[model samples]
Target: MTAKLTDAPVRVMIVDDHEVVRRGIVTVIDASPSLSVVGEASTVDEALRRLPAVRPEVLIVDLQLPDGTGIDVMRRARELEPLQKMLVLTSFDDDSALRESRAVGASGMLLKSSRSRDIVVAIERVAEGLTVWPARAPEEDDELSATDQRIVELIGDGCTNKEIADELGIAEKTVKNRITAILHALGLQRRTQVAAREAARRRAGWK
Candidate 1:
């Protein structure tokens, strides 16, 4: 997902379970000239309802929520807009949590302990289709081709074959065939399983 191609401030939505957490982020965003807070949500349910309405250029989300995890929100949000830019701003730095965020199409992950300036920069970066996550390359790929790697990213972003076709400017049949081959190459039975590891050998980093 990419940010709006304009000079206007980035429209951002903050989703956190705690008001104080949200407020702290809000304060940081408010201080950045290139960012603006458009909406806020305290739970997955509320986030689902408000996210589409706000249609933010950047989404700052927490991993744990009252009703569901931020991965649930990002997954649902990606369904509505596969190009939606998202960043997981969480307190946890474990691999399972980080990989989960990557599995749902997050462009970046930032620890809550990071500096205020880092938060502002992460929002801007994700909005532009650039990653802000700590880099930890996967040990190795299962000999996935370049094209196969791209398909994995789209699948993780909740894109259908048709959608992937449109994004890659290929036929729907081609997309389907490639996905099958990709699954075989990765030794994975389901698309969801392979989505956790992605293109460019970009493994989830714990930092």
Candidate 2:
């Protein structure tokens, strides 16, 4: 059975580059009597233009947009309507994207692989001002090696490889090599990015 929405019909806006995903989400949301898809946008520009007229209660957004990141759209929407609820629906589970989304005021995060019912539930939860994180297995302490953990900690402290090497009594070249390996393992690009992600992870109680 479909879950009943709140007393009033929940207005929703879908922002995704893929037409198929947009249609699928619209269908799922429209299936319920108390939820409606008021607008759909394929790009940040389109979303900005349409949102004013749609005036949705919740926005389901994808991270990778053709024009720009979905975070930009979320930021604009919040500026346009401070009370709007935003839920990030993206394939990117990277810590950087998650942190940026939260920093820009997304109410919840949902993986695209989530079931349609779960997506609907996420929308409702965010609409009610509750945050939801995609379920994941707990990480073991041993997941990262000692060297990797040290590098991560240093990165979180905003230390460059040269500084970390000087502090850790290691060769700067060795520090660089270790940092490269750590970035590859974490699927990250830069030290600052890692630092920001670490801050978000800490805030979210991931570690």
Candidate 3:
């Protein structure tokens, strides 16, 4: 299902350290009647203090703050108001930041250089409970032996250890051992992370 803004105008809060960026976002939001700026905070401490009074519907936040990271702000906000929607605006697009933001329940993410219209759209979408991220495809290739490649493919396909064993005519314990070895070789802590990395690689057009 798609998310939608409330019947009343969506109340928004800006959380960024940069004065110019904050002003720009405020200008874009204030220009629209469907959205309104309720408060602006340049630090985590400031945001925490203003949140209850502002009770914003959406938070447009940068990853970096003078006092703390956006992830920290999101976490604290969730504690204060679990239903508040969060949209991450950041210059950094590293995998760690992406994973961390999603883990902390950010609804959407946009590059800092995104057009004003796009930023507004992201805020609305996030307020509606939609995830906004760049499209990515699954990765199929890795620097592994043919057997390891087969194992990874099966894992990506969601095959259980016993199912993989059955498919390959091997013992379940052997399949488990093989999976452990593959994880070690790839230096990955989790199968899901490995799968995501592989998918990102494919999305980047790498072999």
Candidate 4:
């Protein structure tokens, strides 16, 4: 947290309820030449219990957990180890959660859907007192707004343009144009491809 100066691999911890997700991220972190996984916890209580002993330099945390929440872990860690840095790794892009994270001393946030390289870079920057997560506050319009994500989910569920408009209480023409833009942005030629891709993301709990 104090601008890591040592060449030793930065000590990192991971906290996520899902075993698959925790292990997947551990693999990515351990693979990084400049990082190392020093500890892991699946619940807020567990994280607090281990913090004093493990003493990680940075913590890669998920927003939701079986017990309390990542905010609990971050807040408690701030008390126990003021120098420990926190990096949020979550599936939800909710603005409220982002605000809460920054208030609790999280240095940066990353989506679980981020590329391996991006995750690695985020941890590295946060460890050095640099920042990322658009490297600042959530923009009014990110690459994908919450409304656009809802539309993608509806498409994945096989909703027709008219049905999507009805569900979202918007005009059908607007739905059509949004679909066109989403497909173009994703570099897909057909709506079916969007359906297939987004469907997979939803299945993996990327809401």
Candidate 5:
């Protein structure tokens, strides 16, 4: 495939299954001076077929497609161009989807409800090699149960599973389960990372 001309506007591809949504995104990109919609596809197969000919600088893909999920498209697209950027457009807020998208090399997630300006900004950010997750308000940070927060706090304090269980007056196994869920929710691998993140949040006075 021919590489993008250095002087050309940032080329973007839209892969949402909905025609209206695809048009809406195209309009948004068109209005941005630095970005342009170079191609559009409604299914994973279509996206894969067209991607070789139209290798966009960034791909805005919806998670659910008629042929397969956007994750499938992302994996294939990455194989075609390892450096290609991916931005996920989805209505679902499920953590599993977020984790899977990130795992398959998506750089950002934009809700369908996001304003046009935010969508445009996301496209730019992804093109710039930045990872984009939604911003959460202090109140929104309260998604974790109070118990979960306390558990994370104890982790920050370097508590063991037995220590946390005893402190929270719960079974040790319960503490382990809660910690597992917290890691999944935070998309972290280790307890130390979770603890460090929670500590940073506390220091920053975020909720």
Candidate 6:
């Protein structure tokens, strides 16, 4: 479902190199009473040049642009409007893209294959100052090593380090080290958050 409409619609800009994708996003945003597309750009240079004038409250940017990476645009956008909400809409789902997008101050990230309703909802959440991301990639778990992935699965199973080590036939110290590495890789501060995230992913039908 799309977000509830407020008194003033959130102004948004669409920046994608593909015309079809940009138009599709525009259609989605325009259908929502709470969101409005104020501008569109097919390249980083164009987005940067028009950003000041358009001054959208939220920016839906594709990570790949004709002239430069979306990170470049994000850096420039921050310089122009430090508080402006930016949501990354992209086809790339690599960890580097995900991590870099957040590191450069994106409020959210959504894959291109996400449902239109999900996209709209994510934009609304981002416009309202919430961070948005998928529970997990629907495909392979490429970011984590197989051992680390098993550890995440074990954490989800409510296993303690010693129990997990025993189950996996590894030392408890190695288990602790792998757990710490998993937390760092996912940018999470606690084991509980990692467990929660994995649970969410499982609920979302991730194998």
Per-residue lDDT tens digits of candidate 6, residues 32-147?
A: 99889999999998999999999898888899887898899888998988887898988867778878988989977878887889788778767765666544543435656799
lDDT (10s digit) by residue, model 4, range 26-127: 999989999999999999988888888888999888989988889999999999978778999899667788789989988778889889997887788777
Off by over 4 Å in 4: 135-207
lDDT by residue (tens digit), candidate 1, 123-153: 8767755566653434424245677777887
> Tens digits of per-residue lDDT for model 3 on 7-124?
7778899999999988988999988777889999999899889988898889878899988899888999888887778888898667778779878888667788878887777676
Q: Which residue pairs in model 4 clash with each other?
A: none
Better of 1 and 4 by lDDT: 4
Q: Give the better candidate number (1 or 5) by TM-score.
A: 1
Query: Roughly what TM-score does model 3 have, to 2 decimal places?
Result: 0.64
- Report lDDT (Cα) of residue 145, candidate 6: 78
Best by TM-score: 1
Model 2: residues >4 Å from true position, as ranges? Answer: 1-6, 135-207
Ranking 4 against 5 by lDDT, winner: 5
Expressed as tens digits, the lDDT of each residue in 31-93 for candidate 5 is 989898899999999999999999899998999999889999999999998888999999967
Per-model TM-score, in order, reads 0.66, 0.62, 0.64, 0.64, 0.65, 0.64
Off by over 4 Å in 3: 1-6, 139-207
**Where does the lowest 10-residue lDDT sum fall in candidate 4?**
133-142
Local distance difference test values of all predictions, in order: 0.79, 0.79, 0.76, 0.81, 0.83, 0.82
Model 2 root-mean-square deviation: 14.8
Better of 1 and 3 by TM-score: 1
How far off is residue 41 in model 2, in Å? 0.6
Winning model by lDDT: 5
Off by over 4 Å in 6: 1-6, 136-207
Itemize residue pairs with steric clashes in candidate 3: 139-199
lDDT of 2 by residue, 16-115 (tens): 9999888988999999776889999999999999999998889989999999989999999989887778999887677788779878888768787878
